[model samples]
Target: MAPWGSAGKTTPRFLGQFSHYLFRYATWLPVLIAFNSYVAQVTWIRGPSMYPFLNPQYNESLRKDLCLVSKWSPHRNLERGMIVVFRSPENPHVTVVKRIVALEGDVVRTKPPYPYEHAKVDVGHVWVEGDGDKTKDSNYYGPVSTGLITGRITHILTPLDRAGRVRWWEHAEREGVQKAQAS
Candidate 1:
């Protein structure tokens, strides 16, 4: 015991307890980081690019769609009409969500201003388009590399009335392509 009734003894004990507590939980840090980085994540969608199927209203009072994006889904197996979140090819820092319009080796009809009347998705890439024709997408940037795709959106988690697995039936119908089943 010291003059202050064990004041000298308290500091070491407090530090030891803190070190032990930190050691016990430090092991979970990597797992938590990996889960968020490679497993699944919740994302807030904020734009008119997806429209009717996603954010249908322009009013700020209406909540935006919150979606569950699965990083584990293999981009190579992506089919036409599946919505995916990918890093913009023109600007790697920005992420864009779009529907897979065509897979590798598939022929895609191009819209105005694109040099070719039709374009074939090159190897290791896929053609993506917005649900709305007015949105900027493959029609503007062309086919995007698969490596830029980060995740496949599986479910809408917010706005209870609209919450459910995201389906591409309408988009497929509009594109004249077969709708893909949710994976």
Candidate 2:
């Protein structure tokens, strides 16, 4: 009877330990997931798409203004003129930032003054161009797969500003409001 009593006591202690660990993991799981899900992740600008705005080679100070790409609102189709971070279609391992020039089915003129051969927009793909023509972007590769887009440019987080400002812009042709004549 005494031996049986000792075994019973040990069983409760083991159960308590297990419960503590379970609770700890349960509480931490959501936070870990949220941290990765929509939070601003750091990335390096590889090329000159952004130019004087975000240059890795010329302005060493830019290394401080790390681009903050958020995955929060990516499921929605990107608006024209929004800078975005996306996986390179030619190279999945690489990511590039460029502006949305045209959406699916939108006519984009590609001629002189423009640096590349003319191409019409394709469905399920959008035209993206580097603000700088010389950089690697849709100009070099043509339209990009919508699926490749990771997220729109939300903000740039740098220690320079205490507030962490985000320098983003919208096009004159605001989203949802189209030119009546064009339609």
Candidate 3:
């Protein structure tokens, strides 16, 4: 039999190796968690709510667009045409991604059944809409609290051919102009 503290023991060697890895992982786990929670993370985009900006074409395989979401941006810095990810006010468990159409105190046009053709965004609230005309958004659920916003999408990461920085502002501006002309 080997001595009590001898290096010839396989059990102690295995235990020591396991403990080293455990300690190393434990030390890094919190940092990883913090980064994922407050810095940035990858999010998968599904459905046609974002349409051409995201899931442009309908695929039977249900492949989704992958995006890098920045969690550190302040709400005050968010612009009218920026894309954002937020928790659905109607269902806390669901998350929705949409474009910011109006900020607090801004007047926005509304669709039917809202009692008013134009509505003013309330203080601390924002108006969000999907790129697709048929998408359900503020027009259906009304203005959402800015607090509901979780992050801003910074890049499209999927479909290697389509990977690039997200720049939809020009399109949004053109859409606004067209809407203005149509009205």
lDDT of 3: 0.78
Clash totals for all candidate models: 0, 0, 0
Kindly list the per-residue Cα lDDT of model 3 for residues 94-169, writing each as its tens digit: 9899998877777777766467778788888888888876688888889999998988898999977899898857
lDDT tens readout by residue for model 2, 1-183? 233223445568777667666776788988877865576566655666676556634445434346667876674756677888888989999878888777777766653444655566777788777665467766677889888887776666543452254455434342322222332
Residue 8 in candidate 2 has what lDDT? 45
Which is better, 1 or 2, measured by lDDT? 1
lDDT of 1 by residue, 1-183 (tens): 223233345568877566666765886899988887799989998788887677877455667889998889547578778999999988989988988887777777788767888887788888888776457898889899999999989899988988998876545433433332332
Ranking by TM-score: 3, 1, 2
Would you estimate the TM-scores of all the predictions?
A: 0.78, 0.64, 0.81
Candidate 2 CA-lDDT value: 0.65
Q: What lDDT would each prediction earn against the true structure?
A: 0.78, 0.65, 0.78
Lowest lDDT 10-mer window, candidate 3?
Answer: 174-183
Task: List residue ranges in candidate 1 displaced over 4 A.
Answer: 1-9, 12-27, 59-62, 169-171, 174-183
